[model samples]
Target: MKRTEKKRKDIIDAAIDEFREQGFLGARTTSIAQKANVSSRTLYNHFESKEALFEAISEIMLEQNRSMQPVAYDPSRDFVEQLKDALWGYISIITEETAIGLNRMVLSELIRDLDRSRKFFTETETHDYPMTQLIGEAMDAGVIRKADPVFATNQLLALAKNFFFWPEFFLGENPTPEGVMDDCIAMFMAHYKTGS
Candidate 1:
């Protein structure tokens, strides 16, 4: 990577740690610059302000996870297996150490800034999420009962997050409990699988 790019990455990494430790309001750019081993001027050259840096971190977090290839729906595959694969992929991404810390920081900030939270959610909302697309295709292929794809997608995610994400997010639990994913899939299939 170019020097500029490496420095920028270092700034972001340091900012993540700072924000995670001190929060958006409490974090200071000077601290972040010092942690990154860059001058304050360099930090500002890369990111104009602390808010800008925070926004950049948020964007990078979303982009890093969204860059994963979308799971394609295969008609010949078992619906449960396909759903399991897609759901696990998502769970893995969100449960990563960095992702969890970033999410905690972002959520805390968003709670105090209603307008920013709205903008963040609006910007991030999309129909192309892997599970959503997989469920839509499954519906079209008669593998699942016809329903609102987004709602079904939420149901699946809610189930998985309750076990895999919320506990970890709130209580710092790591390594999802055994059988949680399978149970989530089975419950979702019970509700949505075609001919169930």
Candidate 2:
């Protein structure tokens, strides 16, 4: 990489760690500069303010999430298996360290800046996301019971969050075990499967 690009990445990496540890308000630009082994002037050259640096970190986290886009639902495949694959793919990403840190970081920001948090939610959140698209497709094909695709999508995602994301985010727990995913999938299928 070019020198400037490497320095930019270094600043972002250091800023992420510092923000994760100290939060947006508590994190110091000087500390981030020290951790990145760059002067405060260099950090400022890359980021006009701490908020700008935080925004860059948020973009990195969002990009990481976008990278794990689930495979499109296949009509020929078993619907239950497809749901499992999709949920697992998403769960893996949310349980990642960076994702969790970003979640916490966003929550911290939300306390101080509701507008920014709402904007972030609208832009970055996966609530009305790819999984929702898959759910809608499955409904159109009659793979699942007749239902509101939006509600059903949220329900299934809630199950995954209940089993995985919430616990890890709130309790510092490990990733949800495969057995938990299996149980959640089975429960979801029981209710949503076309003939169930």
Candidate 3:
């Protein structure tokens, strides 16, 4: 990697650690620069301010989320299996240590800043969510009942979050509770499956 790019990455990496450890309110730019092994001036050159750096970190985290392998609908596969795969794929991404820390950091800050939270969620809502695509495809192929793909996607995600995400995110639960995925899939299929 080029020196400049490496420095920028280093800054982001260090910022993540700093933000995770001390939070946005408590984290300092000088401490981030020291952790990154870059001068405060260089950090300023890359990021105009601490808020800018925090925004960049949020963007990077969302981009990483968008980069997960897209799960396409498969005609030959059972809808339950396909949905399970899609949900698991998403769960795996959010449960990663860095993702958890970043999410916690972002959530904590957003709770204090309603305007920023609104904008952040608006930005998040604009993404072409992968599960929505999969559900839409399944609907098109008659594998599942026709309905609002986005709503269906949200339903599945809500279920997963209740069973798999919230515990892990708030309590550091790991490996997921047994049968949680199956229960989620069953609840989703009960509502959305063909002929339901």
Q: Candidate 1, residues 1-196: lDDT per residue as tens digits?
A: 9999999999999999998899888999999999999999999999999999889988987786678677778988888889898888888888888889889988899998999899888877753467888898889988889999888888888889988998889998856775889998989988996776
Cα-based lDDT for every prediction? 0.87, 0.81, 0.87
Better model by TM-score, 2 or 3? Answer: 3
> Among these predicted structures, which one has the highest TM-score?
3
Q: Estimate each model's TM-score.
A: 0.92, 0.85, 0.94
Stretches of model 2 off by over 4 angstroms after superposition: 125-128, 146-148, 175-177, 190-196
By summed lDDT, the worst window of 10 consecutive residues in model 1 runs over 122-131
Q: Model 3, 1-196: lDDT tens per residue?
A: 9999999999999998898899889999999999999999999999999999989988987897778766789888887788887788788888888888888888888998999899999988877667888899999998889999888888888888887778888999866775878988888888887887
Candidate 2 TM-score, C-alpha based: 0.85
The clash count of every prediction, one per candidate, is 0, 0, 0
Q: What is the lDDT of candidate 2?
A: 0.81
